[model samples]
Target: MRGWGPRAAGRRRRLRFDGWIAGLGTASGTRLVVGHWPRSPFGPFSDVMAEHPDGQRVLLAPTRETADFIRRTYSFDAVRVVPVAVRHAGRTWTVTAGPLDLRFTTGRRGPLGLLLRAVPGPLASRPLWSALTDRPARLLMPGVRTRGTAGRGRREWYGARDLHPVVGVTATWQGADLGGLAPVSPPVRFGFGSAPRAPSLTRITTTVEVGAGEEDRAG
Candidate 1:
């Protein structure tokens, strides 16, 4: 497929996930992990077996909630999937539900021309103006990186795996503060494809608020 369709298609299906173990690995001497499955070229990882340096097959939690403390403690986000019930006509019902009420860890906004801010006066703004005036100028800005496709890019940290049925997903990209660096966060984005991880039922409960007293349209 060519044109903008493919990119838009992938963007919409970005939340499909295979399992919680999809996000397993050690980084920065820390095992900061989450269970959310990003778009393909990223994951939908198989939780079947993990290999040790000695080539030993180890067991891992098949689901998020039942995962041991190690997975939970190091995770940046907690997610869960279970049953949800709603009451309206004196009747209650339940259905499998996975809810992601997520809030990204955010940084404060820095100067607009952060790169120029260090250029010893507004002369630094020259680059900013050039980059803005030319479509390709944005590429010249330091720290600007692009995500790759088809098992490439930063998302390809792990090799690859097959795709899975994704019920839904949401991604939220709030702006980031760079000080004298390039912008990291865009305006906004989010994902709801599947819960990033499953923990206690309490962490994923949906809250419903009811408002009292409605006015008549004729009034």
Candidate 2:
């Protein structure tokens, strides 16, 4: 594989997405994580990843472009392009994607959130910073990672700015109530990392860097 160097770096392009990621489990034995991005190279869009009790993984994206990008970066048993809408009022979030309807509320930031907030945005979002913090993040929050390979010769970095406990959630899939909120057990298996075990909403900036000569086709 080609390694990062001045020549390779010059051929790569970076795409950043400013968004909120919410991960939670329902009493019905389904774990769902939602990414609502209001700023991105492709404009605002939302995506949903749901894991059924049977361990089936599905990705619900708002468009083919978004679906292709997400599928390239993560693993999923199935991928679907559907209408995805995400709205929020205060600390509460509402989402509608395919057969899913989710509503959740977040509480005030906690200690970790405060600590993350202290880091300057420019420094925190740097890929180098994310790589340096990956191991520590895994130790501090099991299954969470700040940096990782994203397949297709792309590397990804997650810069978390803030986090808030998900206080409550009411969700339904295919018109079947998913019951109340619970811990995100078993950890989601979408990518190289999972969200914090404790259900929460996190404000983050995700950066994806495409390999040399691949910029034109990357999202």
Candidate 3:
């Protein structure tokens, strides 16, 4: 979701967040929705009503600036933002924007950098970096633009559905299966494409990591 506050006198920063909603309709199965939330707080409502070719509706929560933009641009009855139902790990693992379950380290050079430096030669990690950074090459996005954001973390999961055809499968854990895991976020940044240009504050994400012994206890 985008921040709702006084807009910048000049050009305001552009932030895009992506998330999956409960199946928009039975026919469509699941609807993929994106919001110009940073651009409009009222944007979510517009998306919810907007029809997809596949017969799906989008839900969005536009920032305050977005509300004004809608009035200025479309001239419609903008409604208050509706919080979408976020399904994290179901009852086992709750999903929402708060903190991530994993640890993170940031610097001008982070894991990407360390991996690069550890490798030998001038173009040592370039290929690896490109592979990991560019989603399309890895089949996530088309380009690479590495800027600094406030906080960045990734939730590593093993054995999940195959979402993209090009990449085959998102990076996964070795020798682990029979479970589902998702990266938790406070202000979850949808992976792929580019990182946020704005700086974010650090936060702790609390999660329930089920133990092997505990799994035997029936709910």
Candidate 4:
């Protein structure tokens, strides 16, 4: 999910973010339900509910392109993660989307960079240049802005899901056999799509590796 935060005084950052949300919702054929962080701490889930009074969708957080956030938090495993190389705006990028969130990376980072990607949670933001340099960061915005990364430690299980599709990218499935799970998301099971007539998921994992030139032959 992409995010955009508030901008300088008298700027239309929020409006710009709303436009993005609307566009994404149209493209995805579903509302991009966003988690909202309230200015005041929530007693419980009140923050989320308040932000999404109509439903479970709200304003953007603070991010630019998928590239803005997908650089790290690498190595995710779910039911299935299909990877492919994509070309856009004269650039080649690797896009990977799993159960929790979609990720993008250039695969140029090695040990230290790789370690940062594995930094677990918000803690990944810690030590980031954005969190340090404020003056130069503001130039990226229309006016003054606050920039930084906040991270906790790491956590296991980036996500788990039966099936995931990234529009024009790839498809994947996990323990759910790509939709064999008993119950799908509530909106899906009860709202629009039809459940599988009969889904049988055997808890099994099979790994296949194809060499540089043996892909077709192996298949």
Candidate 5:
């Protein structure tokens, strides 16, 4: 982790979330990244990061608390606190969040997934390991990063454990069909980095380090 000011480094709290992140783009020019965290400081919850063709970024969270926490950790043009539900069966995932209803299927793990699985989870999730892999992550997946500065004086590390390509998708936004699945074309402008351009599902452990002052509000 990069050092901030002395006071900030001295008084900081680390929070971790372990879960699956699915990124995909629809032919209608809408890109969506769904984070379904089954473990976190605030318990299990899921959030959606969406970017429209017009470049409008929106965050759909399950509650006001989750929405606030996400907004503080990332940038968004609009936010909606709604009932976000995610259900998965085997390789298929179904998601319903406010105006969006999406279903996607994952294929067999690719070469990168195989490589990621070889790394021990404990060693891979370490901040030092994340920093060491940052450059390689960028080279392997353009627009993706392992470590970056988050919002509100916070730094974050993305530790990936597994990955699978998204092979199919059918989605709708506000009842209109979003067309077929496509690559995450223009990359999302939510935080310091975007999801992989190839459209896939990644199992990740996200660690966010926040100063003492921000910690109080983050909770």
Candidate 6:
């Protein structure tokens, strides 16, 4: 794998999405966490687990709605949102997204440089490779830091054992303000475009579902 292909990657090994809730955390730089998974049927702990490479994880919810969604989606016992004001440089940066501090930072440059440098080749390299191989050769190799692949370490906190699928709920939340430093928008509503692509949490039943077969399989 060379880089982020315009098409979504296979396996959904890591639940990465298109856009993220963008805001500055108490940390030094602006942090942007993905707001939705480009693929469907994303699970709790999947999104945050994907970001372990960057050394950051979501710790709180940004709004009441977001909090409720997390609980309903993953059947978490409870959740708490902490608000803090962080000072950077000589100036104080107000928390914009309130308790739900979205994660964002200056990461790596995307595939622009590599894509532009892709060379046109075909007949010349034919002796050694066929058209099938040549096309891939023209493409850039995937970044070393891409979400999931061989050699990448697993996140310390969450995993498949922790995954619990819900019909219309998710663990993601919109971080609104940062310790009164900055103000962020509310969580994406059920039908609103702001919501994740997973599903609409309009009437999520809080009752937990326990499948005896699943429990037996685990045992």
- What range of 10 consecutive residues in model 5 has the weakest lDDT sum? 1-10
> Per-residue CA lDDT of candidate 6, range 1-219, in tens?
122112222422221122222222221221223232222122221122111213333434444444443433332223454432222222111222333323222222234323322423222222222223323423432111111111112111101001111121112135323221111123222111122222111101011112222211100
Per-model C-alpha RMSD: 20.3, 4.2, 18.1, 21.7, 3.9, 16.9
Instruction: List model 1 lDDT by residue over 129-198, tens digit each.
Output: 3234333322443322112121111120111121121122122112321122112122101111111121
Q: Which ten residues in a row have the lowest lDDT in candidate 4?
A: 15-24
What TM value does model 4 have?
A: 0.18
Error of 2 at 47 (Å): 0.8
Q: Which portions of model 1 show Cα errors greater than 4 Å?
A: 1-28, 31-105, 112-144, 152-219
Q: For candidate 4, lDDT tens digit of each residue in 140-171?
A: 32222223221111111111011112122221
Off by over 4 Å in 4: 1-26, 29-90, 99-132, 142-219
Residues 40-66 of candidate 3 have per-residue lDDT tens digits of: 223332222222233332223333443
TM-score of structure candidate 2: 0.92
Candidate order by TM-score, decreasing, is: 5, 2, 3, 6, 4, 1
lDDT of each candidate versus the true structure: 0.21, 0.86, 0.23, 0.20, 0.89, 0.24
What TM-score fits each model?
A: 0.18, 0.92, 0.23, 0.18, 0.94, 0.23
Alpha carbon lDDT of residue 35, candidate 1?
A: 36
Q: Mind sharing the TM-score for model 3?
A: 0.23
Better of 1 and 5 by lDDT: 5
Question: How many clashes in each structure?
Answer: 17, 0, 20, 11, 0, 29
Summarize candidate 5's per-residue lDDT along 1-219 as a digit string, tens digits: 122212234678777778899999989889999999887766778999999999999999998888988899899999999999999999999999999999999999989999999999998877888999999999988999999999987899999999999999999999999999999999999999999999899999888887777634332
Clashes of 5: 0
